[model samples]
Target: MASKVIKIAVPVVIIVLAVVASSALISMRKPPEKKEEQRQSVLVNAETIQTEDLVYKIRSQGTVKPRLETNLSSEVNGRIVEVADNFIEGGFFNEGDLLVRVEQSDYLTNVKAAQASLANAQAALEEEKARGRVAEEEWRSFTDGTAPELGLRRPQLASALATVRSAEAELERANRDLARTEIRAPYAGLVKSRNANLGQFITRGSSVGTIYGTDVAEIRLPLTDNDAGFIQLPDFANDSVKPDVTLTATVSGEVVQWPAKLVRTEGVLDERSRVIYAVAQVQDPYQRNSPDKTPLRFGRFVQAEILGDATTNVIVVPRYLLLAQQQVLVVDKDSQLQFRPVVLERSDERHAYVRSGFLDGDRLAVSAIANPLAGTVVRVSGDTDEQVADDAASEEATALTSQVKE
Candidate 1:
C-alpha cells in the first residue's frame, strides 16, 4: 500500500512540473513584427557625354563625266582622202595633231588664185605710187606750191589701195580655208566616235565625230539643304580653296578611292527637286601622277565624302541613345532617369552629333525600357553627372581654401 501511494504522488509531481514549464515558455515568446514594402527600380546602361573636336563629313553620290565633251566638226568643205590610224574610235591624240586630211587639190588651186590676185594688186599699187611721184615732180616745177590732187594721181593711188586691201582679205580667207582642209585636234583628248570615212564628202560645220578632254574629270554631286551646312563649297564667281573630298567606286569586286576637290556648287537650285548640285574634280584621271593612281573612268558612278566645317563644343553619342522628338533619356545626378531634349547637328549610320541641349558630363542612357516615364528611378553602370559636378566643385573649393591658408 505504501509503495502504490509513492508511485501515484510521483506521477502527480511530474504532471505539475510539465504544466509550469509550458506556461513559462509561452510567456517568453514575442509578438510578430511588421516589415516595410520596397518597389523595384529599372536598370539601364548609360554613357558619359564629352566634347570632341570632330571633323564633320557629308556624303553624296554622283556620276563621273568629262570636263569638256566636244562634237568634232569640219571647218571647211572637202572630200576625206587621208585618215590617221589614231583618229579611229577610242584613239588618243595630242593638241594640234592632225587626224584627218581632205584632198588638197581644190583648196590649193583656190589659194594660188588668191595669191595671184594679191600679187597683181601689189604690182598695180607700186605702179600708181611711181606715177604719182613723177607727176608730183612735174607739178612742183610749174607751181612751187602743193601740187593739185589730180596732178599727183591721188585718185589712182586711192583706187590701188582699195584693190590691194580687197585682194589681201581674199588671200587671208583662202589660206584659212586651205588650212582647215586638214582636221587637227584642238586639245589633248580621246576619240569617242568616228563618223567620217575615206572618200566621204564633208561640208563646213558637219559633224565628224565626238571626243572628250582627258585633263580632268568632273562629277556633279547633288546635295540637299541640310547637307550643304556641313561642307564648305568653293565660290564659282570668286575662286576659293576647294575642300578635299574622297571618291570611291566599286571595280572588279573591290572598292577603290581617289582624292578629289570640291570645286563649286551650281549657283542655281534645281527647279524640280530643289537640290543644289556641287561639282567635284579629279585631275589626270587617266594619266596618273603616281604609280598607285587608278583611273576614275568617265561615266562611272561613285560616292563622295566631303570634309566639312568644324564646330567647337559639340557632343557625340550613339544613335540608339537618342529617343523620339529629339529627346534623350539621361541618368541625372540622383540615380534617376530624366528625359531630355537635345539638338541634333547630324546623324549617320551609328552615331548622332549633338550641337546643343545637354551640358557637359551628362550621363546618356542607352538602354531601352518599357513604359518609361520622366523622373523614373533607375540604376546606372557609371558615375552619374551630378556626382562629377559636385566632385569638381568640391575640388575647386578646396583649392581656394588652400590658397587662402598659404
Candidate 2:
C-alpha cells in the first residue's frame, strides 16, 4: 500500500511541476511587435516633355518606269538594206540618229521620175503660154475688141499651170517618201527590242522596234488617306513647290538611294486600293548627265520618303509609350501617376505626335506599369540616388507636418 501511494504521488508531482512551468513561461513571454504595412510602389522609366517644331516624313513604295516609251515603226515599205550599229536591243541612240535604212534604189527612182514629170509639165506650160500669145496677136490683127477666152487659149494655159502644180506636189511627196526610207530615233533613248534586221522586208507602219526615253524616270507611289493629309500634294492651279523625295533600291547586291521630286498626283484615287497615287520624277535616271550617281533603271522596285509639311510645338513620343484610349501616364509634382488624355495630331509606325494635353517639364513614363491606377505612387528610374533620398525625406517631413496638424 505504501509503495503504491509513493509511486502515484511522485507521478502526480511531475505532471503538476511541468504544467506550472509551462504556464509561468507563457506569462513571462512578450507579444510580437506590431509592424506597419508598407505601401507598394512601382518603378518606371520616364522622360521630360519638351515640345519642338517637327517636319513630317511620309513613306511609300513603287516601281520605277520610264516617263516616255514608244514602239518604233517604219514609215515606208521596203527591204531593210542597212541596220545601224546601235540598232540592236539595249543599244543607246541620240535624237535624229538613223537606226535602220530600207532599200533606197526604188525610192530614188520614184523621186527621179516625179522630177522628170515636173520638168515636162513646166515645158508644156511654157509652150502653151507661147501659143496663147500667138493667138492673142492674131486676134488683135483681125478685130481686137476683147479677145474671147477660147481664142486666147486661156483655158489651155490654166490647164497647163494646174498640171505643173500637180507635178510639183507629186515631186515633193516623192522626196518625202524617199527620206522616210531611213528609220531614225525620235528621242535620245535606249532600244528595248528590235524586230527588223538587215535584208528583212517590212511594210509601212510596221513595228520595227521598241525604245524607252532615258531623259526622266517616273514612279507612282501609293499613299493612304491618313498619310495624304500630312503631305503637301502638287497643286496644278497654284505655284506650289514640289516635295522632295528620296528613293531607295537594291542594285548589284547593294542598296542605293536616288533623289527625286513629287511632281504630281494622279488626280484621282485608285479604284481598287482606295489610295491616292503620287508620281515622282527623277531627272536623268540613266545617269547620262550625272555619271557619278547610280543609274535608276526602269522596272526596278523602290521605296520613297517624302519630306512633308512642318508643324510647330508638338510633343513627340515613342509609339509604345502610348496607353489605351489615347492616354499616357505622367507623374505629377507629388510623384503620383496621373492618366493624361492626349490629343494625337499624327502617328507613324514608330512615333506619335502629340498636339496637346501635356505641359512643359511634365514627366512622361516611358516604361510600362501593369494595372496602373490614377494617383498611385511611382518612382522614376531617371532620378539620381541623391534625388530619390531627398524626395523621400521631403515626403516624410510633409507627412509628419500633416499628422501634427491633424
Q: Whose TM-score is greatest here? A: 2
User: Candidate 2 — which residues are off by over 4 angstroms?
Assistant: 1-40, 253-255, 359-361, 384-406
Query: What are the lDDT figures for the candidates, one per model?
Result: 0.86, 0.91
Best by lDDT: 2
Compose the digit string of candidate 2's lDDT tens values, residues 78-175.
99988999988889889999999999998899999999999999999999999999999999999949998999999999999999999999999999
Least accurate 10 contiguous residues by lDDT in model 2: 359-368
Go through the candidates in order and give the clash count of each: 0, 0
Off by over 4 Å in 1: 1-44, 236-238, 288-292, 332-337, 347-350, 359-362, 368-406
Tens-digit lDDT track of model 1 for 1-406: 9999999999999999999999999999886797898875776888788878878888889999999899989988889999889988878888899888988898899899999999999999999999999998888788878777888999999999999999999999989989989888888888999999999999999988898888899999998888887887788555686989999998889899989999888888999999999999998887645547667888899999989988777888887777889898887877677778998888876678888888554588888788788788787745445667889999999999999999
* RMSD of each predicted structure: 11.0, 6.1
